[model samples]
Target: MGFQEFLGNERIVTALRGALRTKRVPHALLFTGARGVGKFTLARMFAQAANCERLPDDFCGECATCQRISQLADPQTLLEQGLAERGESADAATVERVPLILQSHPDVWALVPDPVRLKSPVARPMLRVGQLRAVQRAAYFQPMGRRRVFILDGAETMRWDVANVFLKILEEPPGSATLILTAPSPYALLPTIVSRCLQFHFAPLPQAAVEKILKEKTDRKPTEIKLAAQLAEGSPGLAIEMDVEAAAQRRRSALRILERAAQGHGFAQLFSDTSALAKDRDSSFEHQIGVFYGLLTDLLELTSKVKEPVLRNAPLAKELESLAKSVDSAWVLRAIAGFDELYVGARRNLNRQLGLDALAASLAPAPSRASVTHS
Candidate 1:
């Protein structure tokens, strides 16, 4: 899609279009935002615009250059097409094992994190030093198009060594090349790296925009689309990819924890529940904590008696309202604070059951101290 068709972040679009028109694009551009907020999409669009032969400030999308760049932008589609060409299986396992980079255009290169050793399905992909070295070698070469565009998707996945290598390339960048790096935030990268580039912060899209995109992209039901849009909180990418049923189940589980805490369940029962939930393979502990936080926010809104409360878990309004009656606003506020602490700790490798148990204890009413009879 052209920049005009792209949803949200109109200001960034205008700035990029102006840059293309002026032929004064930055050598190094950093796009930072939350995941699924259109940073990579905009980066790809900018890359296409930079090299589009027919249009100076925007891509024609039908040109040979734009078509090839589009193919390079969508790594998954390129991977599938390549596998089909080679008569290889395009199954989930095979796709997972393959690295996801596409250089369909001589002037465009899209680099993504790849598994360091490809040992297991759960292994996290990282941007290695070798990958940056290849880009550094290619950046100096004259572009087949107007500009050689190198997109480093998920730049935060780079280890310090890899980032240092990338820093060297940025230090002595080629005039013919433009390097685009995407990350969740500038703070996630090295300060030196942040200082070297023209930074663009992508804010989350509006709920209406997210819903519109969901309608266009997904075959989900209207109810599901609305719920996912609300849960996505302005991220069209997240809304499109969200599993409504899975999210509902997580919210239900979170509500159950609140109910048990309100009923003053014993530590043994709470601990047992926590252990079982920890063992659930359907979702990660981090995701569970997020659901819990969302529920706490809803409860706080309900307890505060907000007019027309906006809730992330809107479908569970009846259940949440009932629970809110059992507890006061102060209780909900304390739970929110406790969950916020647990959420921070979720980043590190902590024992899941212990974390859940701690959250449960925090939610439970404090033990009433009884006066002991004088002996």
Candidate 2:
């Protein structure tokens, strides 16, 4: 699609178009923002604009070159497509074994995190040195198009050694190539790397903007669309990709825990509820933790008496408001902090039950003065 098709981030679009108009495209670009804002989409469009045969400063989006570049897919999609082509099941074992770099056009490379060590389910996916080395070698060649574009998705996944390899490329970039790196924030990357590239920060889209985009892109129910839009926290990409039913379920489960804790439930009851929630494999534990965090944030907002506070779980606003009254701002703030730690721990494959237990314990309200005095 052309740049006009990309919604939100008008400033970034203008800057990219200006770069094209002046024919002064930087050799490297760093797009920093939260996940699913539009960094990767913009990167793809920029690559097309740089190489589109039909336009000098913009993409027609119909030319052979532009169409080919648009075929780029994320790693999971690429892997699934490959497996489907082979008539093989995309089982966990099979998925863990594949290392992927999706290239739809010879001149366009889309790099994502692959398992650093193959055949190991626990091995974190990263942009390893080997992948950067391949890009390094490819960078020296003349491209079939005007520019060879490399889009490094999730660039923060690179460890120091791998980042060092990429640093060399940035230090001496090829004349005919442009490198694009996308990360959640610039601080997540190396200072040296951040200093080398032209940086752009992508802001989250407004909820209305996100809702409009969701209507355009997805066929989910209007209610689901509205909920997804609210829960996405301004990322249209996230709203588009979110599993609405699963999100709702997660929110319900998270709210149950909050309710129990607010009512000063005992450890056994809290642990039992947490165990049931953790056992549901419908969604990732990390995602479950994220939902809990969102609920906690909403509770914090309600407890703090924010004027017209926008909530991620708007459907439960009344319930959250009622719950907010049962707890003080101090406990909600502390619970939010606990969930932040739990979210990070979830990413590290922490024991879900144990972590949830600890979180529930932390969320336990202090004893009432009457009870303490009676005891």
Candidate 3:
């Protein structure tokens, strides 16, 4: 629950830690990164570190100030009080604990449209104008805690009005207030808003880090966790996000596919897997799709020995190599084209199961549209 406990982003930890040591931390900091990359966690830690009453090195968790701040016990908590009551630096452990509750925190707000919208016709979430209005109201209030940190979880959902509401605050934010905003990409944010805050870019975590967390957090077999981690594209958030059972099942299914493919697997099993995934009509559908995508990505990574797992076309790798050796790269290229389009179609409105079925059928060893090349 401290900086030491933070799973990834060591450089970020070091920078904030350094700033706290010098007591020259900026008032307006924006933590931008993919979801679940520890931006929010770091923000809360930084908040506590700025005002701990402990020794110079860090916040003493046992201090009266630390106790009050850590538990959010004080209603009248002000930034100066938080800073004054603690050690020269606040306890990172205590602050990190706060973010664990951030999703449900009343004061901590998000304006994103529903994720289920991806399942909707539009496939997009809209951050309404009201969310921005709340930010205005929060800004008008004095510090709720030692600092009133406004963490916009899905900043990309910000509508034009929402982004505009931020312009004023970002330009002249309250002295005691801090904004720890997160988004998948800054390109989605307004350049004006981007210009205002001290932006902290968070890159993806290492695959090893993702694997470690997945293994530790899930009761799934080590093999299953490793598969998910590999396919997760270094996103620990994605790995931790799986419900243990669903994640386990997905891993099992994917491994079965890989095991079969390794052995020049039959087509019926792939068809069955695709059909089964498509049958999940409720919440599990998204998980199934994500798992399927991750599964393909793992196979793709295995094919090229490419360190990054961005390719979800991996299930087709064996065929790719065969075709590449026998024919020109054209056939492999077409296979990729077909799947990429299929992925896009699934992402939009096409039936996911059908897409997977089509993909599976195409990749099948027998009667495939693709003819393998003999080396």
Worst 10 residues of 2 by lDDT: 366-375
Predicted candidate 3 versus true structure: per-residue lDDT over 1-375, tens digit per residue: 346766787888888788667756565666777556766556655655555556443556566545544543221233223324433333444322222122223334333342221113233434445455567667657654344556565676666565787787777777666676666556667788777767788877777888877777777788667666655566776666655455555556655654443333455666676676667554344345445454544444445456643443343345434433433234334345555666557545587767776665555445443543323
- For each of the candidates, give the backbone clash count: 0, 0, 13
Per-residue lDDT over 1-375 for candidate 1, one digit per residue giving the tens place of the 0 to 100 score: 588878999999999899889888889999998668898888888889999979999999999999878876557666455435533433444444443456788888888776433323344456656667778788999988899999998897788766888998899989989999998778668899989999999987878898898888889898888889877767787777788777777678778878888767555666677787788776656557667777888898999999999876777889999998999999888887877677555544466667777777767776611221223
Distance (Å) between predicted and true CA of 217, model 1? 2.0
Candidate 3 or 1, higher TM-score: 1
| Model 3 bad stretches (over 4 Å) | 51-127, 140-146, 243-375
TM-score of 2: 0.81
Residue 5, model 2: lDDT of 87
User: Candidate 2, residues 1-375: lDDT per residue as tens digits?
Assistant: 578888899998899889888878898999998678888988988989999998877899899999888776344666445435533434454443443567888999888876433334345566766678788888889999898999999898788666988898899989989999998778668899999999999987888899999999888899888889887877898888898777777788789889988777555677888998788866656557667877888988888889999887888888898898899889988888887777666655688788887777767666631232211
Question: What is candidate 1's TM-score against the reference?
Answer: 0.78
lDDT (C-alpha, whole model) for all candidates: 0.78, 0.80, 0.55
Question: Where does model 2 exceed 4 Å of error?
Answer: 73-77, 81-99, 115-125, 185-198, 276-280, 347-352, 367-375
Tell me, by TM-score, which candidate is best. 2
